[model samples]
Target: MEGYLDIIIRCVSVYFFMLIALRIFGKQELSQLNTADVILILLISNSVQNAMVGTDSSLVGGLIAAFILFLINYIIKKWLMKSTFFGSLIEQKPEILIRNGRSDFKMLSKLGINSDELSEAMREHGVEHIKDVKLAMMEIDGNISIVTTDQNQFKETHYKRKHNHKNLQGEN
Candidate 1:
C-alpha cells in the first residue's frame, strides 16, 4: 500500500510538470518544426521520463506515469476551452505559402520546407502544378490546404468541351 501511494504521488508530480512544460513551450503546431524544434521534441520525452516514474524502475511506475499524463492532457484540453490565449497557444496560425499560383519562397524558407516537398504535398492534394493552385495555406495542425485558382472556370470549360464533342459526334 505504501509503494502504491508513493507511485501515485510521483506520477502526479510528473504529470503536472509535463503540463507546465508544455504550456510554457507555447503552442508550436507539429507542422511548423524547424531543425531545432525537432531536436527539442526528441529530447523532451527522455528528459521527462525519470520525473514521471520514480526511481523504482518498475512497470508500476510506468503505469502511474501514463495515467497521470492522460489526466493532465484531459485537464489541459478542458482549460483550453475557457482561455482564449490557451486556444491560440494550442492552435497555430495559418500561413499562406502560395497565392495566385505563385510560391512564397520566403515563407517556405522560414518554415524549412523546400520547393520539392511543397510540390509533393501539392501533388498529394491533386494539384499537378503550382500554377493550378490559387491559394495554399499551412494550417496550424501541420496540414496543407490548397485551393485551385479557377475551379468554376475549369468546370465550365470541361462541360463546354464535352458538349461540343457530343454535338460533333451526333452530326457525324
Candidate 2:
C-alpha cells in the first residue's frame, strides 16, 4: 500500500511539472510534428515512464500510473472550465502574427517563425500576399488562423520542416 501511494505522488508531481513546462515553453509546436518532433515526443514519453512507475514493472503499477494520469487530466479540464483564472495561467494567449496586412516581425522571430513558414500557412488559406492578410494569429493549440477581408476565416497547422532523406522529397 505504501509503495502504491508513492507511485501516486510521483505521477501527480510529474503531471504538474509537465503542465508548467508546456505553459512556459509554448505549445504551437505540438500540431506541427516533423520527424524531429516525433522523435522528441517518443523520447520524452519513455523518459517519464520510469519517473511515474519507478521500478515496478508489474501490470498493476502501469495501470495505476495510467489511471492517475487520466484522472488528473479529467479533473484539470473540469477545473479549467470553472475557473477562467486557472485556465489563463495554464494556457498561453493567442499570439498575433499579422495585423492589417503587416507581419509582426518581432513576434515571428520570438516564436521561431520564418517568413517562409508563415507564407506557407498564408498561401494554404488563399492568401497570396501579406498585404492581403487582415489578421493572422498563432492559436494556443499551435494552429495558425488567418483572416482576410474578402475571404472567410480559416486555420491550418502544417509545420514546415526540412528533412534530408533519400525517400523523402527535398524542401522547396
Candidate 3:
C-alpha cells in the first residue's frame, strides 16, 4: 500500500507537469505530428516512465501509476466543464485573425502565421481573395475558421492547423 501511494504521487506530479508544459508550449493538433515530434513524444514517455515508477518496476506499480493518471485526467475534464476559471487557465482563447477583409498584421506576426498559410486557409474556405473575407479567426483548438461571402451567401469553413498560435499581446 505504501509503494502504491508513492506511485500515485509520482504519477500525479508527472501528469500535472506534462499538462502545464503542453499549455505553455501551445498545444498542437495530434494529427499534425511530424517525425521529430513523434520521436520526441516517444522519448519523453520513456524518460518519464522510470521517474514515475522509481525503483519499483513491478506490474502492480505500473498499473497503479496508470490508474492515477486516468483518474486525475477525468477530474480535470469534469472541472473544465463546470469551472470557467479552470478552463481558461488550461485553454487558449479564440482570436480574430482577419476582420472586415483586412488582415490584422500584428495579430498575424505575433501568432507566427505567414501570409501564405493565411492565403491557403482562405482559399480552402473558398475565398479567392483576402479582401473578400468577412472574418477569420484562430480557434482555441488550433484551427483556423474562415468566414466569407459568396454571392450574398455567408460561408464558414474550419480546418486544423499543424501549429498552434501564440497569444497576441497588446491591441488584438
Candidate 4:
C-alpha cells in the first residue's frame, strides 16, 4: 500500500512538471509535431514510465498511475475552462500580422516569422500581394488567416482612386 501511494505521488508530480514545461516551451510545440518532436515525445514517455510505476511493475500499478493522470488532466481542463486567468496563462492569444494593407513588423519579428513565410501564407490564401490583404492574423492555434475584399470591389476602389487622381491633375 505504501509503495502504491508513492507511485501515485510520483505520477502526479511528473504530470505537473510536464504541464509546466510544455507551458514554458510555448503552445507552438503542440501545434506542430515534426520528426524531432515525435522522437522527443517517445523518449519522454519511456523515461517517465519508470518514475511513474517505480519498482512495482505490476499491471495494477501501471493502471492506477494512468487512471490518476487522466483524472488530473480532466480536472485541469475543467478548471481552465472555468477560469479566464488560468486559461490565459496556458493559452496564447492570436496575433495580427497585417491589417488594412499594412504589416506589423514588430509582431512578425517577435513571432520569428519572416516576410517570405508571411508571403507563403498569403499565397496559400490566393493573395498574390500583401497590399491586397485587408487583414491577416496568426491564430492562437498557429494557423494563419487572411481576409481580403472581393475582386470586383477592389477593382472599383482602384478605378475610383485613378479617376479621382486624374481629375485633380486636370484641375491643377
Candidate 5:
C-alpha cells in the first residue's frame, strides 16, 4: 500500500509534466507534423516511463497517468469552448494556403510547407490539380480544408440522387 502511494505520486508528476508540455506546444493538426514533432513525442513518452514507474514494473503508475491525462484534457476542452484567445493559444489559427486557385507563397514558406507537400495534401483529397481548388486553408489543427468551386452543386446533385434512390426503394 505504501509503495502504491509513491507510484501514484510519481505518475501524477509525470502527468502534470505532459499536460504543461502539451499546453506550451500549442495546437497541431494531424496533417501538419514535420519529422521533428513526431520524434519529440516519441522521446517524451520514453523518458516519462522511467520517471513514472521508477524500477517497478507496476500498473499503478500507468493508471494514475491515464486518469490525470483524461481529467486535464476535459478541463482544457471546457476552457477552449469558453474562450477564443485560449482556443487560439491552444489550437492555433487556420491559414489560407490557396485562394482563387493561386497558392499563398508567403504563408506557405513561413510555415515551412513547400509546393510538393501542399500538392500531396490536395491529392489526398482527390484534387488532381491546384486549379480546381478555389479556397484551401491550413486549419489550426493542421488539417487542410478545401473548397472547390463545384462542391456546392456537387452536394446538391448528390442529395437529389440520394433522395431519388430512397423514393425508388420506398416504391419497391
Candidate 6:
C-alpha cells in the first residue's frame, strides 16, 4: 500500500512538472510537431518513465502510475474548462495577423512569423495577395485562419491552414 502511494505521488509530481515545463517552453509544438518535436517527445517519455514508476518494475506499479497520470490530466482539463484564468495560463489566445488588408507588422514580428510564412499560409487558402485577405488570425491551436472576400460575390469566407505563429500580443 505504501509503495503504491509512493508511485502515485511520483507520477503526479512528474505529470505536473512536465505540464508546467511545456506551458513555459511553448505549447505550440504540440499543435504542429516536426521531426525534432517527435524525437524530443520520445526522449522525454523515456526519460520520465523511471521518474514516474521509480524502481518498481512491476506491471501493476506501471499501471498505477499510468492511471494516476490519466486521472490528473482529466481533472486538469475539466478544471481548465471551468476556470477562465487557468485556461488562459495553459492556452494561448488567438492573434490577429492581418486586418482589413493591412498586415499587423508589430504582431507578426512579435510572434516570430515572417512574411514568407504568412504568404504561404495565404496561398494555401487560395489568397494570391495579402490585399485579398479581409482578416488573418493565428489561432491558439497553432493554426492560421484566413478570412477572405469572394471577389465575385463580395462575401467573407474562412479558410484554415496548419501553421505555427509563436507568442502573442492581444487582438487587432
**TM-score, per-candidate, Cα-based:** 0.61, 0.84, 0.86, 0.78, 0.63, 0.83
Report the alpha-carbon TM-score of model 1 versus the true structure.
0.61
- Residue-level lDDT of model 4, residues 1-172, one tens digit each, is 8988998999999999898898776545654455667898999999999999899899999999999999989998999899999988877788899998999999988766677677766665667888888988877666667788645532211110111112211010
Q: Candidate 6 — what's its lDDT?
A: 0.77
Best-fitting candidate, scored by TM-score: 3
TM-score of candidate 2 to 2 decimals? 0.84
lDDT of 1 by residue, 1-172 (tens): 6766777777677666655675454333343455565787679777867665657678876776678678777887898789888877654567899999999999877766677667766665667889988988876555566788755533211100111112211010
For all predictions, the C-alpha RMSD in Å is 12.5, 4.4, 5.7, 12.7, 10.3, 5.3
lDDT tens digits, residue span 77-101, model 2 = 9998899999999888889999999
**On a 0 to 1 TM-score scale, where does candidate 4 land against the true structure?**
0.78
What's the distance in Å from true for residue 48, model 6?
A: 0.9
| Candidate 4 ranges beyond 4 A from true positions | 151-172
Local lDDT at 143 for model 6: 70
lDDT of each: 0.63, 0.78, 0.78, 0.74, 0.63, 0.77
lDDT (10s digit) by residue, model 5, range 1-172: 6666666677768876765676565434243345566787799889888787677775765676567667767887899899988876666677898998999999877666667667766665557789888988866655566777666434211100111111211010
Q: Alpha-carbon error at 101 in model 4, in Å?
A: 2.1
**Per-residue lDDT of candidate 6, residues 1-172 (tens digit):** 8889999999999988988897776535545665667888899999999998888989999989989999999999999999999998877788999997999999888777788778877766778888888989988776778888656643333433323433222221
Instruction: Give the runs in model 3 whose Cα sits over 4 Å from its true position.
Output: 29-31, 151-157, 164-172
The number of residue pairs in model 6 that clash at the backbone is 0
User: lDDT tens digits, residues 1-172, model 3?
Assistant: 8888888889999999988888887645432565667888999999999889899999899988888989999999999999999999987778889997899999888777888778777766778888788889988776788877556755545565665322211111
Name the runs in model 6 displaced over 4 angstroms. Answer: 151-172
What is the lDDT for 84 in model 1? 85
What's model 4's lDDT at 123?
63
